[model samples]
Target: MTKSLEGRVALITGASRGLGREIAQRLAQDGASVALLDRKAHWAEDLVAEIESTGGKAVALGSDVSDRKALTAAFESAVSALGRLDIVVNNAMWTKYAAIEDIDEESLDRMLGVGVAGIIWGTQAAAAAMRQQGGGSIVNIASVSARLGLPQAMVYCGIKAAVEGMTRSAAIELAPAGIRVNAVAPSTVATEGVRAMLDEATFEARVASTPLGRLGATSDIAEAVLFFADPMRSGFVTGQSLLVDGGISVALR
Candidate 1:
């Protein structure tokens, strides 16, 4: 019996935790040999072990996404280890919240460095591998902040918007090579980091705004990514951003 991703290899940045972790696990379960890239090497290693224990194939790569050379090398190493790269997910990002007036240079630079530059480098490296392998899919983890005005998150908003724009441009350029580029924009998800950051009131308000009346689960976003990552599911989809926000993007605020 052939699996959905049988014989395919996938590389996912930020695979140590949260949505990235789930995405990596999902891909592996679907039968892809997953390369888990994360700055926290130990975490990725642990996840890789867990996946392997479940009869899935996975490898951990500790590489800083912000470093173009390191990221490029990591992509190559993934290919060498996994055999070939067919799916790439640019999910690593850095963010620091500050009001527009309080925004600082360092924070902005770091956010853009990882969110923007990292995606660019990842796309470049993956395109090179995928073009050689015949074709591939790339999924950028964007955010609803890119489409909505969020106070104290201007930098994050801008960075995500940039990612969405890049997704479209890359799709157009890579289409000729049979490479597909797309993005998944998720709203506030109930991850450990988010739960720690949002107080009760704020959290409830966010959930209330969503038609689903609940925060997104890691699996929700992971399923959306799987859709984009599989050619059989999204063969004709490209240059588009799917909002996995449970109708929040449409609810009148």
Candidate 2:
């Protein structure tokens, strides 16, 4: 009765809330020991407890993913605590919505720092740890905003587009080292952050625009991530981006 990721160790950034939290729990349920890394370490402790209650191994770490040194240290700590590293999900991000003309330099820097630089550092750290283990998988959480222009989300869109490009380039570079890189792009998922950002009318409009006729659930994105994280499910898949937006990306509507 061995699970697909029975002996795997995974690290997920932004694991304190929303989609990040869901992904952590799902991976744990599949028997992968998880390290939940967030800006505030204590924010993830409750999730750690929940996973442990289900007989899963979990740990929480605090670090600014934008800082290379801090991120590398967190990765090292994750491996030290979990015994090894086999998977990583680059899911942490910070964003602010403003008109293109109103975009501030500080907010832009923070968004790029978290959304772009964070992925790079996470990839570097995960690859180093996985190199020793022979091979591993890394999944970056992207957004459909990368492909479609959304008002007040210019910076966020740019970051996600960069993520996809990096995923491809990193896959090619790391593939030789036995590490696979990929990304999952989700659209209008009903996460706490998404809910907080959108008004009722906006939320309904998002649903109406999707062919699926409903907003995506956190589990939906988590399952997409699991497909990439589990070697048995996606061993030969790399350098690809799966859009888990319930048909929103392709719908004519």
Candidate 3:
């Protein structure tokens, strides 16, 4: 760990567990103080404790990213606690696996609310904060589903695609302000949530489809996020969506 992100402050939504938790730990390991925000705020307590135990700075803030006002307040709270905001990872999302026709109105709204609206709100808050500080970075956790349409995942795919679109537009609009916007699109990762969604046979089939012969791990996505978060390494890179899918994004299925 080179402390490349030393003294930088990072705010990550859905930081209680899974990919968000991994991103938080990874950023903290690189020397950035992290603010973990989640709807279930208590879930982040253990992660915050773990980071602190490892001599890293972190705080757990219970806030729903879908709620613009609450999310804005959380962003301010993060800045208040960490002094300044340098990075924002809009990784929170609400999704349900269902066929297009089977999807209900509530599910559709929730997915868009957290997955799409949440990103917009988070970016707006982060961009404002970063402007005051001269510049900053914002990373959105997209998905390979955005590139490949899958059955029973239409809503998820649409929301992710929206995120990618937003990233590009925000990058262009925020660049002049020194705020960079980017996204990471990951394939199926072996997380509890993903495992629950896919059966063993389906998981095996997915692994076979990937060129690397294995499902992605949380650390894989976390590493890509680190690249975008570090200005020294990716200062000139923005509006780009890096795929961390173990080469699956390129395989001609």
Task: Give the winner by TM-score.
Answer: 2
Displacement of the residue 176 alpha carbon in candidate 3, Å: 0.5
> Per-residue CA lDDT of candidate 3, range 1-253, in tens?
4689998999999999899999999999999999999997798999999999999999999988889999999999999999999999999988798976799999898999999999999999999899998999999999999999888998899999999999999999999999999999999999999899888999999999999999999999999999999999999999999999999989986
Each prediction's TM-score against the native? Answer: 0.98, 0.99, 0.98
TM-score of 1: 0.98
- Lowest-sum lDDT 10-residue window in model 1: 39-48
In TM-score terms, candidate 2 sits at 0.99
Q: Model 1, 18-130: lDDT tens per residue?
A: 98999999998899999999986677888999999998889999888989899999999999998999999999988799988999989888898899999999999999999
Error of 3 at 122 (Å): 0.2
lDDT of 2 by residue, 73-153 (tens): 999999999899999999999989899999999999999999999999999999999999899999999989889989998
Ten consecutive residues with minimal summed lDDT in candidate 3? Answer: 92-101
Candidates 1 and 2 compared by TM-score, better number: 2
Clashing pairs in 2: none
